[model samples]
Target: MHRHSDAEPDWDSLRERIIGLGEHSIHKSYYPELQDRLAELERFRALLDQTSDAIFLIDAETGLLIDTNESAWLQLGYNRERLMRIPFCNLIAPASLAWFLEFFASGQNRARREQVTVAGLMTADGCEVPVEITIRFVTFGDERYAVAVARDISERIRTERELRIKESAFESSTNGILIADLEGLLIYANPALLRMFDYEGVHRIQEKSITDLFSCADTDTRLLARLYREGAFAGEGHGRRNGGSVFDVHLSGSIVRNDSGQPLCIVGICMDITERKQMEELKREAYEQLRKNIEQFAILGDHIRNPLQVIVGIAEMIDDPLTAKILNQSERINDIITELDRGWVESESVRRYLKRRERPEASFAKIFRNQNNPE
Candidate 1:
C-alpha cells in the first residue's frame, strides 16, 4: 500500500461528492439532479391527477395510447398498465368510434389544429361516460402525437336535455307566451303569441315595446310597476292586433329571476277572451230586451182592461134587449182580459228569475269595473 499524507482527506467533502452534492470532487455523481427532476415530474403528475379532466397522449400513426393521467385510468376503471396497452379507439364507445376514426384518418383534426367534440367514452364495466373532448395534434422530434383532454359532461348533457324539453313545452303551449327585458322590450315571442297578435313571425314583434301590444296607454307602465313591487300581475285588458283591431285578453305576468334572486327579465302569458266578452255582451242585450218585453206586456194588459171597464159601464146603464147580449159578450171579453193578466203575472215571474240568475255575473262585472277604475 502507498504511504498516506499526514493530513487526513476531508471526509465531509468526500461524502458530499459521493452523494452528488459537492463541487470540485473527482467522484461527483448526478444523483441529486436526477432526484430533483424526478420530484418535479411527480409534482406535475399529482397536479394532473388532481384535475377532474382525463388527459391522454396517443401515437398519431398507430393510434395507440402512449400515456394517460390518473383520471383517465380511474374514470375508465382500468389499471394504468392495462389502459396503456389498449388502443385509443378501443376506449371510445362503439357509437362514436367510427366518427373518431374518420376524424383522424381524414386529417381534419390536424387541419383544424384544435377540435372539440362530444362523445361517449366506454368504461371498464361496459358503461358509457359522456365526455366533451378537446383534441390537438403536436410533434416531438420524430414522433407525432394526439393530445386529448376529455371532461365528463354527464350533468351538462342532462341539463341540456331538460332545457330542450322546456323549450318544446314553450313552443307547443296553447296560451301566448312572451319574454321581455326589464325595459319592456320584447325579446322572445312564442308561436302562440305571434298568432294571437296576428303577426306572421317573431321578427315582427321582437324589440317592440310591450305598450305597443296593448290598447291601454298605461298598461305597460302599470304592469312593470306591479312586477317590480309585487313580482306578479294578473287581470283582463284590451290587446291591439297588427291591424289596429282591439280584443280582450286575460294577461298574467311575473318577474323572472336568476339563481341570486335578481330579476333577469319578465315573462307573460296571454289568454284570448274576445269570444267570452262577446257572449257576455249578447247575454246582457238579450236580458235588456226581455225586460222591455215584460214591461210592454204589462202596459198592454192595463190598456185593454180600462177599455173593457168603459164598455161594461155603458152596458149596465142601458135597458134595451141588446144590452143583455152586450153584457154577456162583455163578460166573455173580461174573461179573456183575465187570461192576459195571468200571462202578465207569469211573464213577471220569468223576468224575476232571469234577474236573479244574472246577479252573480253582474256582481263580478261590478268588481272588475272597480278594479280598473279604482274609485
Candidate 2:
C-alpha cells in the first residue's frame, strides 16, 4: 500500500477513518476510546427505539422536541422532522394545554419526582388519545431537557367506564340481588334485597349466611351443590323474612366463574311469589271441592231417579189428564237431574242450591210446575 504524505480530511468520513487507523496509528489509544463512546450512544438510542412507550426528548427552555423515538412518531402520526420543528405543547389537547405548561414551568425544581400524569395527546387527524405520562428533567452537557415516557391508556379508560356502568346497574336494580362466595358467606346485597327481607340496613343482612335466609337449610345445600355442577339453578322456595315469617320466592342464580372455569361466586335474584302461591292453593281447593260435588250430585241423582221412575210409571197407568201431566213433568225433572250429573249445567250454581237452607226439592218442584204450565 502507498501512503499519502498530506490530504485534506473529509469531515463526514472522520469516524470511519479514525477507527481504521487501528493499533499502528499514533492516535490509536484515543481513537478506540472515541469509538467506544459512539457505540454506547448508539446502544442507548436503540434501547429508546425498542421501548413500547413513546419517548420524547424536549428542550425545557424552548418547549421543542429535541429528539424522539420510533414509538413517538407512530403515536403522534408525525415524522421525525415535523416533530422536532414543532413545540411539544402543540401536541397536547387544548384541554390539557395549561397542565403541560405547568409541568414545564416546574423545570428542575419540580415538586414531585417521577410522578405519573394522565393527559390527552392530539394526533395528526385531530383525535385526542388518552395517555399516562411519566416525566423527569435530564441534564446533558450545558442544556436541561425533559424526557417523557408516555403509555397509551385508551383500553384501560374504556374498561373502567364499562365497569362503572355495570356497577350502577347492579346497585339500581329493583329485584333483590345477592352475591355470595363459595363458602356461602354473603359478599354483597343490593338495596332491594335488604328491603325484601324486611331489613333496615345492609349490615344486618351481611351478618346472616345465605342458608339463614331460606326456610330450609338442607334445601339450600342441595341447591348450592346443583349450582356447582350445572353452573345455574332456578326454582321456587320459601324464604324467611326479618320477622321470621316465611314467604314463597322464585330464586334464580348462576355461578360466576374465572377464565379457568373455576367457580368464584354465585349471583342470585329473588322475586316474591307469595300472592301467586296463595292463589294457586285456592284454585286447587276449589277444583277439589268441585270434584267432590260432582260425585255427590251423581249419587243424589241416582237415589231420586229410581223413586221418581216408580211414581211416573204408576201415574202412566191412569188415563186422567192431571196424572198424565204429573208423569210428564216428573220425567222432565229426572232428565234435568241427569243433565246436572253430566256437567251440562254449571256446577257452582247447583252446589249453592243444594247447600241453601231453603229446601232444594221445593225449588225443583217450582221449576217443573213452571215448565209444565208455560202460562
Candidate 3:
C-alpha cells in the first residue's frame, strides 16, 4: 500500500502503449513481406507462360483440367475460361484417346510416377496436332495432380519422312553409290555397289579403305586430296573385284558438306565402263587393220608400175610390130595402175576422216610415215 503522487506515471496506461507499439510494428513489417511473396508468385507464373511447351495441371481422379498455362489455351485456340471447363481427356484426338484412357486407367502412370507418349491433340478447327507428351504425377498438399508437358513434333515427323524418301532413292539407284568417312574408310555401300563389286553383302565392303576397291594404289589419297582442294573429282580408273579380276570404272565423287560448308563425309557414284572400253579397243584394232591394208595397196601399185615402165621403154626402143602391141598392153597396164592409184587416194581420204573421229592416243600417223620414209 504505497502512497501515489500526481507526478508518478500510470502503469496500466504505459503497458497499453507498449502493446500498441508492438502491434503497429508487426503490421508494418508483415505487409511488405506479403507483397514480396505475391510478386515472386506473379514472376513464376509469367515464366511458365513464356515457355513454348504447353503445360497443364489435371485432377488425377476426375480427369479434368485443374489449370493450364498460356500456351495451352493459345495452341488449342480456346479462351482460358472455356478451356478450364473442358475435361483433359476431351482434348486428345480420337485416334489417341483409347491409348491415353488405358494408360490412365491401368494405374501404370501412378506406379511409374512419370510416362512419355506421342499423341495427337484435337484443335478447335478439328485438325489433329502431333505432340510428344511427358506426364508426371505430383502431389500438392492432399491433392494429386498430373502435370503434362507437351511439345509439337510435326517438324520432326516431316524430316523423318523426307529422310526415308531419300534413303529409298539411294537404295533403288542403278549406279553404285557409296559413303565414306574423311579417313577414306567405307561406311555405307548401296545395293548396286555391293553387286558391282561382286560382294555378297555390304559388310564385305564396309570398313575397307576406298583405295582397296581401285587397282591404283594412290587413288584414295589422290581423290581425297582433290576433294579437299576442289570439292569434287571425276575420272576413269580400273576397279578390282572380289575375285581379283579388274574392270574399267568411271567414278564421280564429292565432299558431303554441312550448311556451313564444312566437310562432313564423302559420297561417290560409280559406273561400270568395261563395255565402253571394249568397244574402243575393237575400234582401234579395226583402224589398225585398215591402215595396214592401205599401206600394202600403195606399195603394190608402185612395185607393179616400176616393172611396167621398164617393159614399155624396151618395146619403144625395139621398133617392131610386137613392140607396138607391147606399147598397147603397156597403155592398158598404165590405166590399171592409174585406177589403182585413184583407189589408194580414195582409201587414204577415208583413213584421214576416220582418224579425226578416233581418240588422239589411237593415232597411227607416225607409224605410217616411218614405214614409208624408211628412216
Candidate 4:
C-alpha cells in the first residue's frame, strides 16, 4: 500500500488492493507495529464512543476546544467542527472564569483526576447549560491536553432542585419527616417533624431518641425493627410529642441505600393522627353542643312558624276588610323574617325585591319558592 508521507493516508483502498494484488509487491504502509497500534486506537476510540459521559479535549493556552465526541456535540449544543475553534473560557460563567484560569494555569500534574465547578456552557440558542466537569490533565508529546468527562446533570440537577424545593417545602411543611439509622438512631427531622413532636422546632428534636420520645417505646421497638428490615414498611405507631404528651402517627417508612447497595439510612414519613384519633374522646362533648343547637332551632321554628300559621288561619276567619288585610300583612312579614333568619334569602330574589317599589305578597312568595328550590 502507498501512503503520502506528509498527509493522512486514505488506507480504505489499500485494504482492498492488498486483498486483490497481494502484499509482496507493494510497499504497504500497514506494517506489523502500525497495524497493532491502529487496532489498539480503534478499540480505544470505540470505548470512548460507547461512553455516555461527554468526553472532549481542550488546549491549555487559551482554553480553546481541541476535539470532542458526539455526546459533547449534543450536550454543549455545538457541532464538533464548530466547537474545535471556540475558546473554552467563553462557555464558562464570567464569575468563575478567573478562578478557573488561575486553577488551570497552575502547573498540571499529569494523570490526576480533578473536579471543577463551572457554570454556563453556551448553547446554539444562546442558552447556557450548567455542567460539573471532571478533567484529566495529560501531556501528549509535550503539547498539553486535558480530557474532560462531563455528565449532563441537567436532569439530575433539576431533580435535585425539585428535591431541594421538596426538602425546603418539607422543612417548613405541615407534615413531619424523620430520618433514622438501621439501629433506630435518629439522624434528622424537619421542623414539621419537630413541630409534630411539639418540641418547638427542629433543634429541640435533635439528640432525642425514639425510645425517649415514645411512651410505648417497648411495644413499638420490635415492630419498628421488623419494618426497617422489610422494604416499604407502613403502619400505625404511637409517638410522643413534647411535654410527654403521647400521640398517634400513621407511619410510612423506607430504607435508604447508597450506590454500592448498602443500607445507609432509613427515612420515615408520618401523618399526625393524634387529632383525628381523639375523635372518640371528643365525640360526647361535640355531640352535646350540636344537639343543643338543633333543639333550639327546632323550638324557634315551632314558636315562630306556629304563630304565623295561626295568624293566617285567623285572617281567613275574619270577614272585616281592614282587620283581614292587617292580619294577612303581618303573616307575610313573619314568613319573610323566618326565611331570612334561616339563611334562605338568595341574591336574585333580593335583587327583584329591591328593584320593585312595592313587591306584591304573591310575587314575594313566588320569589321565596324559587329561592327555596333553585334548579
Which is the leading candidate under lDDT? 1
Name the runs in model 2 displaced over 4 angstroms: 1-27, 30-44, 112-115, 200-203, 344-375
Q: Clashing residue pairs in candidate 3, if any?
A: none
Sort the candidates on TM-score, descending order.
2, 3, 1, 4
Q: Which of 2 and 4 is ahead in TM-score?
A: 2
lDDT against the true structure, per candidate, is 0.84, 0.78, 0.83, 0.67
For model 4 the local lDDT of residue 215 reads 49
lDDT of 1 at 245: 91
Supply candidate 3's per-residue lDDT for 372.
Answer: 30
- Candidate 4's C-alpha runs over 4 A off are 1-30, 93-95, 104-115, 180-185, 195-212, 216-375
Ranking by lDDT: 1, 3, 2, 4
Worst 10 residues of 2 by lDDT: 359-368
Tens digit of per-residue lDDT, candidate 3, span 187-243: 999999999999999888999877888765434455566556777766777788999
Q: Could you tell me how far off, in angstroms, the CA of residue 53 lies in candidate 4 after the best superposition?
A: 2.7
Candidate 4 lDDT over 1-375, as tens digits, reads 655675775476676567645455243545666789999998988888777777878877667788777777777677777877777777666766776676677736433336566455667678767777777677789798767777767888889899999779778877778887777778789877777787776666666665565444344454455555455555555677677777777676788889998888778787787776586347546645655665565577667777777877877787877876777688777877677456423433443454465322222123223333544
lDDT string for model 1 (32-119, tens) is 7778899999999999999999999999899999899999999999999999999999999998888888877765444776779999
User: Could you tell which candidate, 2 or 3, scores higher by TM-score?
Assistant: 2
Q: In terms of TM-score, which candidate is strongest?
A: 2
User: TM-score: which is higher, 1 or 4?
Assistant: 1
Q: Local error of candidate 3 at 170, Å?
A: 1.3
Q: Could you tell me the TM-score of candidate 1?
A: 0.73
